[model samples]
Target chain A: MNGSTSSQKHPLDGLLRTDRIPHIWCPGCGIGTVFSSSLIAIRSTGAEPMKTAVVSGIGCTGRGAGYVNLDSYHTTHGRAIPFATGMKLANPELSVVVFSGDGDLFAIGGNHFIHAARRNMDLTVICVNNLNYGMTGGQAAATTPYLAKTSTTPLGNPEAPFNLPLLAYACGATYIARWTMLHTRDLTQSITEALTRTGFSFIEVLAPCPTGYGRKNKLKASDLLKVYQEKAIVKNGANPAETILDLEQGITLGKFVEYDRPTFAQNYKAVTSD
Target chain B: MEPAVLTGEHFLNGDVACAEGALAAGCRFFAGYPITPATEIAEHMSKRLPQVGGVFIQMEDEISAMAAILGASCAGAKSMTATSGPGFSLMMENIGLGITMETPCVLVNVQRAGPSTGLPTLGAQGDMMQARWGSHGHYEIIALAPASPQEIFYQTITAFNLSETYRLPVLIMADEIVGHLSERVIIPDSSKIKLRSRPRPKGRKDRFLPYRPGANGVAPMAHAGEGYMVHFTGLTHDEKGYPVMTAEAQAEMVDRITGKIRKNLDRIIQVERYRLEDAEVALISYGISTRSSLAAVDEAREQGIKAGLLRLLTVWPFPEDMVRELAKRVKGLITVELNLGQIHLEVQRCAEGRAPVVLVGHAGGSVITPEEIVEKIKEQVG
Candidate 1:
């Protein structure tokens, strides 16, 4: 069957590759739901998909660039930020979006992602936080919540998961928002907001890795997503990370923090003028 | 024409001129960390790019500098970086990235003594080999070796074009001697010289795949936000840019990228053959050392040595054919340069052991003398 056939009625129906589905992601693996939400976000941006560039570094979420039909750049692990920055700067008119994995973005690619945000570059970064490295069979990640069990962290995670939104907020991203796949609609809206925003926009999507992290935790992807559905508080109401905590819990993830800040493009323009 | 102005114009060193050349070429993005002899290019770019509507970022380190320029290139500006020896070594990963991704960019390497940080301020063409095989993967690069500030100015433009047209990074090997030597260069009008830009996808932008080759090996690139698929990875990838780690796919993928350069060698390889016809001896050289070799050839000819000169403008493709033909015509070939001896070996191999090869070499910041090269010619001719 043709892959583009699924979105027959929805604007994004033709945009997705459904046949590739029966996906590698487990149910409640927020990646697929978030992936669907991203399609929705991109569809809503009204930016010509043809003119958008999707660049990803290695990871489950890094695959986002591959699924998109537009100029999709799947670069080396942890280097997508620079590539995306280059693509955006090469053609300031194009909307550059980065779909990166937590390990890829916060660990290996941490420096570039932070600087790009600081530059308030005119691009959007959608960080899919599964809390562990699922692509590599579940290694501990910077975003892996504390006490989480994984292949490497079989004894439970010792380090606290990075507050990605707080990091981005501190790095000076103009738009910073937090959401989880359980709140797919809200996550999609946040992604849409990040996509449409004029400056550097970073959205932390607390996705679940149903197979690796979820299986290890004995929680199905759906169970964790339902946990998200039940536990997640609104940005205006509660923390986004706190909503994603385990059977025991810590941080929260609603729209944690956001503010107005001139982007790198504007600052660079000012630097050039001066 | 009017008598050549000989040296009245304000003289700028070749390395400095490379910076000016990049500025003249409309390069807006420069990312580099300071490194010996080549530091002048970065210093100049840092001071000058800001004067234009350009940006110069002194990366925390060379690796980041290399990564940043690759980033800037996708931003759709003519991007460049400069280094010598070790710093150039740091840039290899991203240099490989620029190649596989077909990002148009320039990397200037002012060769200094090598292997490690051998001679910080000293001169050596030791990087001739690394410039070709520095990155781990199989690929072909357009590396230009200029002898004068004037050539550096012109060649920088060519470097940009070669990079843009081929959608790959071009290396400028400006050895320390030439990079520091003062020379006069006339910045030409933009229209007078050739320029090339990567071809953009036609019809639907959704059809744009970053790694797909167009009529030429290089597919037109759409910058980020241009709404195209641009997958650039060090891994083996298909034209559509999805990762293909299979050996067959790797072979095909590498072949296409390297082949674009290898097959187009005739268009990329450039050499200047001076007085090779009926000459009994020929001296081959590049960079500032070419000047001293030219003088040596003239002296040897005045002494009736029947010596000629062949200066290489393009180094990486090696100009093997031209060197072979010159070897056949001349009884003996003398390769002279500032290094202990680098390009000479390349000339010898290209000669295919056809003739007696004399290597006139020098090292570690000292200029090779014309007298020394003439002595080599005398010994070879005799």
Candidate 2:
């Protein structure tokens, strides 16, 4: 429809449920960009599409699992990580990825996120940080920057946002990265790397919610992308503690941490053996 | 080599026997959090599961425990989790997910008294109704009540079989007394044990509709990595397992899930009758209360009153037809339970005023005594 004829197929057509298209994301929402990049990465990585399962919690990002042509699960709010953990441990051969929003993954599900990382479960968790609960009408989320105005924070958010990478690093994530929708190539590559990497790998995608956070902040989708393009410093291997997001100064992007550790399954086997 | 079935009479508690029962039934994955009375089950499972080449995880909490077992079940493993009232309350949300996803797993709720952590160490039959309607929304569930440690061992296996048969979560509702009480449990040989596995999907993997029910109204299940590419959700889904939000879709989906058990109620429901033939008074009970009612029936019979006991091994599916038939033959019925008349309400409705129904109930923290139950039987008979 967008300059492509009906007969001209999309590359990710086989990887998606095409009939469920005209997806619910609003125009200029960065979730589509991030989702498309993920599909491309999954394809590029040569991961068995059927053997890969995507699990998601409630929110717009959570809907990604539904449209994906994989063994996906759309679980309850704040529960994708635990559900994916189960799927991974139950069958170690399957590649499990948890894709959900900041609110769904860090608010109600924050405990699960930290614990899963702590346990170093073999999972790839992709948190699409839109900075607010977009599906619930742009309410303040755990990733909402301090002083940001949301529907629930009309007076300005009093709480400081979580430094997601730092949290993952503190909780013993074996691999960690942060990228923006503007960094689609890097983000996609990071996802591909995370999928192949063992143990808990976390990727935080700073996405724009044009209708939610953007509308409230007086920044359009283009303006949001411009901010990431102009202000984002590509700092590969930067210390996670130094990667705190400060939109007024600059944002840092790139892979931060990658190391080997005995995963939950490995440790479980080791401890259980005589 | 240790036998799969620990085939010998051993004095064991309900929680330990339950763990052994799960082992014998081929449950290979158990994820649970420790709570009083139910903690023993997890402890035993942690020691036993790995020895059998199975897995046991003490999850972060009850919520994750429930999710983990559901995940294990989806991956083609018979899985189980054990918890008490407070932990069971935490599990209600994901238990709904298990039901909606049609995942076959077993959950053992060793009952403790509670609205919110009411009594942690004490036993109560308060969760009987919760087991039926704990999770939100309308859906049918199978719950078996065991009166003793021996019964619990057998009932645990039965729970697994029913869960596999229906492709839904089956509950073993054991009270704190039964969970902690020790008694002789005779576990038969592994060859003698009946095990049920979920029916595998037929046809090509690509065309298989994960939610499409067969003639028996239960869809075959496919594991996660088996390349079925199945999509599961808690939302209202169609036969293809895609979310379909409409009144018609909701009706069809709800009916299929609830109707599967409702239509096959005769096969799912199990009741134990004792001397009910030509009885003037019937003592209806389940779980630990059935033990007391059994004693009460003996006392009432000694007093020359025609008394009988109806023990509900399967507390759900209500056993409505059987209750209705018993109501026509018996002049009066006394329902005994540790709760404040939870199942008594179901018995009353089924009696339909053909016979006077009375409730001998306790609030919590203790069991209803045999003397108290006998008194209720006398009052009902008089």
Candidate 3:
């Protein structure tokens, strides 16, 4: 038989399950962009594919693990962090990454996210903040900005959204960064850096959910990207509390925290040795 | 370094014994939250696991603990967690995920009274049915009930073995009385102990299908970072571990999981019979009530009445065939338990009018008395 033709191959073919393409994300959704960027970052790290595992919680972003050609676990709703935490503790040699949606990682699984960060567990958490629950038909989520219309908040959401970078900073994450899908190069670079970091590293990608968070607000995918282009400011090392997102006010995007401390495994080893 | 098993007789409570048994069974990872009657298991594991080079984590809540064990199991460590009624309820969602993913792990429920935290320090068998059906979906489960510290020690090992062999979560249903009560437990030598491990994938790594079954209907498991590229999910999946959202896929998936246990009931079910031969009346009980029922059976025999006991060791997958055979020969079958009627309904269904089934039960907080069982036996027999 002749060798496989180049015409049939994609650039990131080896990193993804090509047969599982035509993924569940709707057109104009930014999850696919975030997922592809993550894979590129994983490849750039030169990490052994066999020694890396990806875990995801339930939602549109949760399907990221299934399409990746790695040891992937599509876990229950709001449980990816704890699951990845267990994997890291069980075998500290392996690199564990959790890829999930904003609602799953912040709303229902909020407790685990904070605790894992506080413990400085060795994990890379990629949170796709589409603002609303995209998979559940645009319901109001923990990251849904105030005055944004959603299925559950037709009149406009009254509850404030979480400033994720600030939350991660407050929870003692060793490395924290925020970027949008429009900044693919920076997002991929941020993920690459986070993957090599020793403690709990977090990257928040603000992506467009045109079908969920956009339709009611009369914003298309291009409009959202234009907003990011005009209002996004690169303010590295700015105070985390001052970096909250507001459509009217500019949204700051850059690495907010970077430091070194003993991870959970290192501390555990010390205690056991003592 | 700590020895795997103590290998000597020691008077220990049921919770401690369970922890020792897990360590002996090669369980190296434990994640649990503190709950009444089950907290001792976590405490014991915390002190002992580190010495044995095992990992012990006290999670923020029960949900995380359950999820953690599943993750640890996927990382090639035998993992377990312990909790009580409320915590057990919290674990139900993840337990279903475990069932769907076919992850081999052990969950010990040191049951306390509850309809929502009914009694924290007292024993109850109210969660027996919940252990089987609490998770939202159709699935089969294996749960073992232990009546004393010695039995819980042995049963904990059995739970791990069953989990490994069947590639599913196994439950240890120990009530509060059995959990806190102290008794002599003799842990056997490490070399003498038997352990079952999940089968490893045999074919080429590139072609390995995570959910493909073998002759026994159990798929070989490959741990994370093993170069298997295995994908596991809670959605209804095909043999390739790919999500298939169709009724036909659901039928095939649900049938294989439930059918594996149902088809192998003979190997999974365990019941102990005491003076069951040539009996006119049979007393069916499990957990703490089994001890009282045995005493009542002896009293009935001494009084020249032909009464015997059938003690269930494996509660789920209900030992229906054995009960049906026993029901055919007896005049009446009585189920004695701490709850009003849980396993009694199973016994009644299995009897199928071949014999009259009677329930001798109570609300909770304590074990049923032998005198009460004797009274029920007399009333049923007459």
| Candidate 1 per-residue C-alpha lDDT over B1-382 given as tens digits, one digit per residue, 9 for 90 to 100 | 1111122344789898888777767688887788878888988876676676677766556766777787778767899989988888878877888888788899999888767878888787778878888888788888999888888987888898888889899999988877888977776555555667767777786565566677767777766545454555656778766667699999988899988888888889888888878789988888777888888888988998888888888888888888898878888988877666678788889898888887888665677889988888878867
Question: Of the candidates shown, which would achieve the greatest TM-score relative to the real structure?
Answer: 3
The best candidate by DockQ is: 3
Clashing pairs in 2: none
Cα error of candidate 2 at position A77, Å: 0.7
Residues A107-152, candidate 2, lDDT per residue (tens digit)?
9999899989999999999999999999988999999989998999
Better TM-score candidate (2, 3): 3
Q: What is the lDDT of candidate 2?
A: 0.91
Q: Write the per-residue lDDT of candidate 3 for residues B1-382, one digit (tens) a residue.
A: 7787889999999999999999999999999999999999999999999999999999989999999999999999999999999999999999999999999999999988888989999999999999989999899999999999999999999999999999999999999999999999999988988999998899799999888887888989999999998899999999889999999999999999998899899999999999998889999998888999999999999988899999999999899999999999999999998898999999989999999998988889988999998898889877
lDDT of 3 by residue, A1-274 (tens): 5567976787888989888888999999999999999999999999999999999999999999999999999999999999998888998889899999999999999999999999999999999999999998999999999989999999999999999999998999999999999999999999999998799999999899999889989999889988888889988887888896877698899988899999888888889876
> How does residue B180 of candidate 3 score in lDDT?
95
- What is every candidate's C-alpha DockQ against the true complex, given to 2 decimals? 0.44, 0.77, 0.89
Per-residue C-alpha lDDT of model 1 across residues A89-160, encoded as one tens digit per residue: 556777778888889988988988788877777888888888789888888988777788999999999998
Q: Rank the candidates by DockQ, best first.
A: 3, 2, 1
Query: In terms of DockQ, which candidate is stronger, 2 or 3?
Result: 3
Better-scoring candidate (lDDT), 2 or 3: 3
